[model samples]
Target: MKVMTVFGTRPEAIKMAPVVKALEASPHIQAQTVVTGQHREMLDQVLTLFEIQPDHDLNIMKEGQTLSDITRSALQGLESALERFQPDLVLAQGDTTTAFVAGLAAFYAKIPVGHVEAGLRTNNIYEPFPEEMNRRMLSTLTNLHFPPTAESRENLLREGHRSEDIFITGNTVCDALQTMVANLPPGRPPELSHLPPNCRILLVETHRRENLGEPMQEICRALRRLVKDFTSVEIVFSVHKNPRVREVVFPALEGHERVTLLEPVDYPVLIRLMRE
Candidate 1:
């Protein structure tokens, strides 16, 4: 069996790495990888850490690309790659535009699509903006749904997906987390070494589209309050690269001594930070 896996973002790379490894190890499966490059540097960081080199890279990232740009680029790039590779099945993970478009392209080509972490629904599709809708649409295009929980499997069944096509597989993020934690080096990360030994660390990651303006300001204000009220509590915020998120976050929290705003770390570093 030939399997081609497509992914682009940091989260998708982390989640799909284990599946790609498993496919490569299988005696009957030939595994191939394609990267859409929706998140260039961040995506590459995860791929490097996992030692995954893609067979094809679409290199679709641009300075101010819109959602439509990403979807259109991925669809075109993947269609050509799929035509060349012609795998028995195409696989995509999570709810990024890359994943959704990859599945859509495969469906158009009459190739079966296997979706990992499928059947996740907020019902309010607009709540998570495109992510919720992306997953829902992929659920319709997918031939095999690898849901992370029984609840997710039930969600698929409730949506009228055949039980035979749905499989309850555990989340790949947890699998990646466990592997990274086990291999983590001793002691605190060098970046956090400036703080006192007894100081407690609070890691924060906020980049939801819904939290863009006023909500983001409120979150920053809350963090500022927390640092002010507690001397021993230090915050390590891995800020998103989006200018909109940075605009509100930096001004609200930057000058504070206890709050350290940083560029996003790679997957293993993130896992190590969480473990510590």
Candidate 2:
């Protein structure tokens, strides 16, 4: 069976890498990758770390791109690729614009779509912005729903998805994380060299669209309080690339000696940093 796996963000790449590897290992399956390039450099970093070179790269990223731009570009790019590849089934993981549009394109082409990490819901569509809606929509079009947890499967069932179509596969992120951790070279990442000996590490990662403005500022303020109260703790935050996130984050968190606000690290580095 020929399967086209489409993904484009760091989170999606991390989760989908293990699934792609599993597919490649299967004697009966031919696995192919298509990257929408929705996240550009960060996406490429994960791909390189996982050694997943896409058969088709739709370089769709643009500065100041809107949701409509992403959806339109991904739909157009994926449609052409779907026509050319014509896989037996198309697979998309998580709830990015890439996943939603790729699945939609496959539906339009009368091809089956397999959704990985499916059935996640906040019940509030606007809470996570488009992600909650994206996954919910994809669920309607998906032939196979791979939900990573029992709760996720239940969510799909409650939504009237057929039980036979739902498969309770464990999260692939854990698989990826374990694989990387096992292969990690001895010693700490160079970035953490400045960390005081025996200090507790507090890794902070926040880039939710719902928390972008005031909520994000409040989080930064909370982090400030944490640093001030906990002298022995060091905070290493891998800042998001979005300027809006940075605008409030920098003002609240920057210039603090205990808070290390650095550029987002690659997947392995992130894992390593978290380990440290």
Candidate 3:
């Protein structure tokens, strides 16, 4: 069985890493990894942490690329890979544009798609922006659905998908977390070099389009209040790569004492930071 696992963002990579590893270890299955490069550096960090070498990297990320651009480019690139590999089934994780495109491309090619970590829904399509919409659409196109919990499986059942095709496989994030936690990298990352020993660390991250502008500024304001109220607590924010997010975040959080703004860290580093 030839199974090509497709993903793009860091979260998808983290959750899908264990699936890829399991596929690689199976003697009867041939696994191919295809990365869409939607996340660029952050995506690469997860791949390296999991020791995953992709069979093909689409390199689709570009400066200021919109969702439409990503959809068009990923669909075209994956089509080429499908034509070349002709795999028996395609596997996509989560609700990113890359996963949706992977399913759409596989559907167009008359190949079955196995959706890992499937059937997650917020009911409101616009809450998570395109992700919620993507999840709903991907379920319609999926053949095999691997929902993480009974709740998620119920979501699929409510949507009229066949029970035989749905399986409760649990989430891969737990597997990945266990692996990373067991073999945690030594010492504080250079990103946290300046932090004093044993002081409280308050982590922050805001990436959704809905939280931009005023909402983001409000979050920064609350962080400032936290810093002002708690002298012992230090703030460590992992800024998103998107320029629009940075524009709002950097202005509000920059130049504050004990508030350290940083680029995205490696998966293990992030885990370690959270642990401390």
- List model 3 lDDT by residue over 1-276, tens digit each: 899999999999999999999999999998899999999999998999899999999999999899999999999999999998999999999999999999999999999999999999999999798999998899999999999999999999999999999999999999999998999778876777888887898988887889988888899999999999999999999998777789988988898999999887778878888877
RMSD of each: 1.0, 1.1, 1.5
**lDDT (C-alpha) at residue 42 in model 3:** 90
Task: Give the TM-score ranking, best first.
Answer: 1, 2, 3
- Candidate 3 yields a Cα-based lDDT of 0.93
Candidate 3, residue 268: how far the Cα is off, in Å: 1.6
Worst window of 10 by summed lDDT in candidate 2? 248-257
Cα error, candidate 2, residue 267 (Å): 1.0
lDDT of each: 0.92, 0.91, 0.93
Q: Model 2, 178: alpha-carbon shift in Å?
A: 1.2
For each candidate, give its TM-score against the true structure. 0.98, 0.97, 0.95
The local distance difference test score of model 2 is: 0.91
Off by more than 4 A, model 2 = none
